[model samples]
Target: VRTYKLDTVLLILKCTQESKGCSWYIRAAKIAGSDFFSVTRYRSKHTCSRAVQSSSNCRRRGNPRLVAAVLHEDYPGQFDTPVPKTIVDVVHRRAGVTVSYSTALRGKQLHVSDVRGTPEEGYRMLFSYLYMLEQENPGTKTNVQLDADNRFEYLFVALGASIEGFQ
Candidate 1:
């Protein structure tokens, strides 16, 4: 198993058992001035193999939170055109776990959908904003652009104000 220390930014590896005199462990420290970690010390051999179980129940695929965090950190601006393969690679590199294409795609979909609500909800919010503006200021002009599917495309609001002495 592996553990992370956010305060020190160090990764620690140790035997599954916590008994004393167990010399199987490794400590990795982050190198300064670079995004790399070096193993400070390692025992290489293990004597607690008998105590370890044969079967494992831990997940091999990256979890949803981990996938989402990696994608958000790696692709902050590429949400509109997210590449699933690229996300998969990022997750593997950052978390030391390989995720399938479908997992990556689902993670991106969840993140994007959360940020950009459904088409109906988006339109409702847009219309409410337009209504608020019109009610607050009389004679305000608002224009909305819709796509072929009746989804919101663009918004233009004129506050009935002159720009550079021109209306």
Candidate 2:
């Protein structure tokens, strides 16, 4: 359930064993002037004796989008993309959450695509960028190498100002 006051928003999440008076619940409140949230009250121990604490439902699951966002925060402007195993390890270590390899791969791919545009869109924008560069800077040399099927393979550019400065 969600309850909010004039300056604070309160959120409460309960376990499925609530019918038996389980104390497993989390209560968090939003800080007044910031995007941060603080957990004011929480109970990790469940009172009910149904052996549900070890179940999958009781574990916290991070979705693909949440994983992507975490990756962005953890590794800003990162080089050397992390593999699925590394992604899982990082999430487990940092967030205490276990994610599947498939999910981790999807999240990493999503974050990478968000940072670097998709291949089709990138190729489309490359022409526009090269044209603008050549037009704005006279003597700017640009070359695009393509393969047999007319696909992008390589790109080379020489800025006019740089060439002039070199000479």
Candidate 3:
């Protein structure tokens, strides 16, 4: 099992079996205000062995780049509707590597950001596009609703009978 401390951001791992003299343990601490972590203490190099067989196909879980590429390349149109199981199946089929749902989710998030840009940038582009549409076609009705924070809540656009079929 693994345990984490909130104050120092230290992680401790120990064998689940309740033995007083178990040498299998690891302790790691996060560098303060940094994205780095260091293993302060480690033992049981030989005392602990794999209790269950590890799959060779599980290597892709560590490769976010590969997972992102798979998500973007294989299911471009299904980005908003992608299921984690579908991603797992595709990665296994193409690269013969298995990944967890969380890994697939992270990869999907990366792919979405890569394709759609950040939310702030997207909102900026949206406003610009709306302005451009109003400029190109005069008398176009464009309405935007925002919350108390001035963030986007809703947007409505009417082309003002330019199409001639619908009023």
Candidate 4:
């Protein structure tokens, strides 16, 4: 048997498990669509097909709340951390580029403490977190540009690109 990490185990359980109200994949499909497979493409080239194939059986299994609960155990942040405005200003000043949304939300201040981690470390962590968020809420456009320093930054949250500090 393939040994899975806690997150993977929870993901499989979430995407494959079912319940009376709805199954894991059914709900996820509503959010992620049949291309739920595409989300897992990085894990394995065949993950998409396998995930879709297993989705059917998962619907019969009943109740994915447990899986959600399990996944939550691993993912404590609810995407609640606010993307700070200072970071956004720094990004704009450093990048010498205007990220779309940042221009609009310029006046609205966000607390840096909420997303206060090392710039590079936070960059990677936030990317993974937002990637998962993209899987859950694939609603926004993601655009990326490099700063004058050549550091990467992202546009919208749904777009899945990293923002050096741009909100």
All candidates in order of lDDT, best leading: 2, 1, 3, 4
Candidate that would win on TM-score:
2
Whole-model Cα lDDT of every candidate shown, in order: 0.73, 0.79, 0.71, 0.37
Residue-wise lDDT of candidate 4 within 1-167, one digit each (tens)?
Answer: 12122341133323322232222331111224331222332222222334345433322221223222222343343433224344344345544433333432332222222224456787777667766776765454444577899687545544424333356
TM-score against native, each model: 0.46, 0.52, 0.48, 0.23
Off by over 4 Å in 2: 1-12, 21-59, 120-124, 135-138, 141-158, 161-167
Q: For model 2, give the 10-residue run with minimal summed lDDT.
A: 1-10
Model 4, position 8, has a per-residue lDDT of 18
lDDT comparing candidate 2 with the true structure: 0.79
Off by over 4 Å in 1: 2-15, 19-59, 118-124, 132-167
How many angstroms is residue 30 displaced in model 4 relative to the true structure, after the best TM-score fit? Answer: 50
Candidates 1 and 4, the one with greater lDDT: 1
lDDT of 3 by residue, 50-155 (tens): 5632333234343556678887777674547367678778778887778888887788888887777888888778878988988988778788999999878899
Candidate 1 lDDT over residue span 1-167, tens digit each: 44523345587876655364456778888899876679898888877666565246465578666687676676664556358888788788889998888888888887676567787787678788898988987777898998999876888887755332364
Question: Clashes in model 3: which pairs?
Answer: none
Give the clash count for model 1: 0
Candidate 1 has an lDDT of 0.73
